[model samples]
Target: MTHFGIICPPVTGHLNPMIALGYELKQRGHSVSLLGWEQHREMVEATGIHFVPILSPRQAPQPDQKITSSRRMRLRHKLHRLKQRLQPVDHQAYTQSNGISALRIALAAYQHWSAIALRAAPAVIKAKGIDVLLVSETSYGGSTVAEYMGIPFITICVGIPRHQSSAVPPYMTSWPYQLALWARIRNRLTYAWLDILQRRILRLLNRYRRDWNLVPYTTLTDSASPLASLACLPKAFDFPVSLPHNFYFTGPYINDICRKPVTFPFDQLSDKPLIYASTGTLSNQASVYRCIAAACDGLDIQLVISLGGKGRDVALSNLPGNPLVVDYAPQIELLKRASLVITHAGLNTILESLAQGVPMVAIPGVLDQPGAAARLERSGAGKFIALKQLNAKRLRKLIQEVLQDPTYKDQARQAQAVIQQSGGVKHAAAIIEDVLDLAHISV
Candidate 1:
């Protein structure tokens, strides 16, 4: 039997797609193992895959931030990361977030996590007899591991920028045309800096890689210069501008919805249009959730809101007569029934919402969320609101606009129809198998 090994960041945005891939493999009789933090054990276990826990030297990472959502600030974000790398701080205590400060924090964690893997991963690889290594696009040291093991590696593209860092070529892709020429030049310089940074990081990783007594990989194979990458998202939502072969656009790999399904309160609004408000797994902004809830109050349409992370305690109690207030709700189920989705613009959530043909009210909080929201607006599927201006009154107006404009739903439905027919998770699994087959052939 073939074995697949996965390493991913702890966040659900990273972990969930990996889990879906693992489950897909398990159903086909392949043994799967996951490497992650303890908090994600249950998520991996739920997929029926063997889970292996890994630890960093310390918790509470300082911050590794990058700007991914907006092309306007992405170069600036990279410059910020470069400055952090040049300046040495505690480094061990930062979470990998999307801002400059956050990126500074993650750089240390990325190195620390890889350093630990240097000793531990080889043992696991030998023990599992892994055939292929599917590393996260944003995962710290996974690309290096695949090289160290001499195994086939495939990176999953959950979003743009960081997720595309290891796989997509920097030179080939450029910022949107609307960006000023100076900004584009700056973005190019930032990309060059990142390219240098990635090379240095890989050099450090390769030292341990050689120590593992494994055959080393060439720079190109290990993402030395990225161009065109693969993803499971649908082409209708995201089309490849440059590298068509690089992306395996398998559509959104929604986690299997068969777990006895949680029943949300959407059944109450059979007549009025239904809207779902969610902030996704990370950056669960209470302010956004409360604002959405408050705006939704007294509306005739049914409202289901998800306030994830830490807790789902949405304090917007005593709603205006009609809106249903729930701390947590079945998002997938809600999206299927929803006419509109109020969201933080996460790729997974945004794609799922679009796949279901539900228009969006994108409230960009941090990171690629704003980009996802912008995509929605550009595609005519939704509107984007910066977190600073998000409020009930604004949301109420947006929802009304979405309802009045048939084109929004029509646009969303177009994307949904395309994604639904684009082969979703099953197709993604098939692509992975092909990559594995190619790996075996090469070996």
Candidate 2:
């Protein structure tokens, strides 16, 4: 049996997939150890995997009262949204919302992540332990640790495919360039900037590494093996990569492994089409909820609204003349039966919906959402409605048009077909095992 040490962010979005993969690996006789916040340790251990504690400060408290989806202090929102573009903004603000602490928490996470990897190195070397370190493309810890161990390491990208030069994940944007020259130029500039940032970050980490008990720098992502990593994303979306054949697409990993808490009372809906609504975890706008509620009011349809964790904030009244109001709905479950979806265009939500064959209305919030929303529009799977422009009238109108049209559904189905045929989790797992086999043979 091999022991694999993992370092992942403490957030639910990041940790879920990693946990799914680790659980699967454990079922196959391999042991996985995770280093993350103590808050999440119990959940990790519940999967029958070993968990190591990390010390990161707690994020500041949020507004004490429950807020309506679209309700916020107007003045505060204007200022906050303005800074969204200039992220890494005061980093302090990030704490209350995402449970981010001071810069030290981020630093602590890095240190904790690195230390776990470093400590695992002796186990790896002494036991001929891990065959290779498997890392989420977003997590720098395992890769850094791999460098120190001088062992083969692979990255498990959770998002869409991308080239080596990016400060964020590639799946955050839709890269369908009608103009090759423009696309190349964009990539080049993006690469240049990313390279500068990566180098800068590496410099900081390298200094902290020794003090934090980590090894020295390793090569950055390679064209050869740079990130010829494993991915839980499907093969259809994998596109043709510039990397080697060894790079893999593992079907959607660990996130789906858990039994979903969401459900829909299908019996309640009318015979008309279904529209699934969600603004994702970060931006669960009530505007979309109110608008969708209005749009479907008199129609013979079903509207399943997932307000992320803010359902109560949406204030469901007697009811939409045609829809059912639920605080949380199983997105994939509902989308499978949906004629249309209203979303915040988050990468995870959009990808999952696309995979389920549902067209969408993408209302992007901060971060990479706007970019993801634009791509959805480009893919013909959805249209973008900036949060600033979102309202009941506009949202209701958009829902009506999308529901009335067949073209959007067709496009969604086409994408879905690709996703369905892409040989999801099993396909992804096979690729990872293949990498392990190759690594075993090579070293």
Candidate 3:
């Protein structure tokens, strides 16, 4: 049995899928452990997987540290200002400026976390005697750690596909798929610009590689595992593009049976067609929720807004619609009953909605969400509006279009069929085992 070490960001969206994959591997008689911050120890251990604390005591956030908390608040405020600055007029200019701002913030965070991991991960992996590693695609530090130790690792694409292709637009933009030569040129130029922006991050990583006497990466994509790369995205939900031979689409790494039970007020739900709205576990802005409530105010549907555990500050009673607002809701259960979903175009939410045969109105805010939203519109499964362009009237119109038209639901069902056939955690596990076996043979 292979002992696997899982590495990913501590956020809910990334952690949930990686934890589910770890749980599946453990069920198959393999041992699995997650290396993360000490704060997430309880959350990881609760799933029956071992948790290895990676951050030094000094680096870890203290519960009573007012300074750390204040810093976080300030960062949140800065991000909010960036989002607010994105105007509907001059869409291209705003998209570029906002995208750059977001990327700068993300890279800064990653660089900080990666420095900690580089210092701590080698000792942790050695102590645990891990045989294989499963690193999240976004967790570049994990890949570096695996290489430093000369251990085999696989890349798990928990978010959108990050493979660079001239035919596909960058993941940060909501541009639709186009096959024209000019579209390819635009894609190439955007990619070059992104590479230039990421030069500092690349330099930081390469310095460590040179220190370790290992070959330095030329580009960010060079860090991905050559053995295998697994994505939770289904083929039908993605744009038609060629992927690397080692890459495999293994559907979503979801295990409902392994999830902790959540308490939801089912009786409060009305008989009218259900419209479930969420902005995922992060990016919970009160203004976005207000707009959603206003759009659904006079509609015939029953609206339920989930704050994703980040909306405690939002006053529910003051919202325009008397919608059922909760700090958190059992999303999968609600999706089963939902006639439509209004989402932030998060991959997990979109995949879950599709799995339930529910159409969506996507409002992509940041990161890979715009790419996922673009694919949603391209697939005919749903429609999307830029977050800057979102208003009560426009959102309500799209909501009506998705609900009144049967075509959206039909397309969702088609995607549902593909998801059902695509093996989830089990398939991913099998692929990991196969790659491990192949690596052993080569050795």
- Number of the top-ranking candidate, with lDDT as the measure: 3
lDDT of 1 by residue, 338-375 (tens): 88888777888888888788888877644456546655
The TM-score between candidate 3 and the true structure equals: 0.89
Candidate 3, pairs of clashing residues: none
lDDT, candidate 3, at 31: 93
* Model 1 TM-score relative to the real fold: 0.76
Clashing residue pairs in candidate 2 are 20-254, 221-226, 222-226, 231-250, 250-428, 251-424, 251-428
Model 1, position 180, has a per-residue lDDT of: 53
**Tens-digit lDDT track of model 3 for 1-443:** 88899988777788889999999999999999999877788778888999998864235332122225555465345434433432222323323343456566666556556655655677778878887889998777778878878789999999888878999899888898899999999999999998887776576667667655579999989879999999999977777889889999999888775566778999998899999998862233677888999999999999999987755555456888788988888889999999999998999999989988999999997788899999999888899998778899999999999999999999999999988899888999888988888778221
Per-residue lDDT, model 2, residue 440, is: 64
Candidate 2 residues 1-443, lDDT tens each? 66766655555556777787777777778777776667787778878888766432122122223223344354235334433432222322332232112322343444444433333333333343555566666555566556545566667766554454323333334355433666666766765654554553354346435533455564335312353576655554443345566666655653454534656676786666887777754433444566667766776677777766665544556555646667767666676788887876666677778778788887765544555676677667667776657676777777777777888888888877876676665565556666667656332
Output the better candidate (1/3) by lDDT. 3
Model 3: residue 347 alpha-carbon error in angstroms: 0.5
1 or 2, which is superior by lDDT?
A: 1
Over 4 Å off, model 3: 56-98, 281-284, 441-443
How high is the lDDT of residue 328 in model 1?
58
- Which segments of model 1 are wrong by more than 4 Å? 55-99, 102-116, 161-183, 189-229, 244-246, 257-271, 281-284, 312-323, 439-443
lDDT of 1: 0.62
Clashes (backbone N, CA, C under 3 Å), per candidate, total: 22, 7, 0
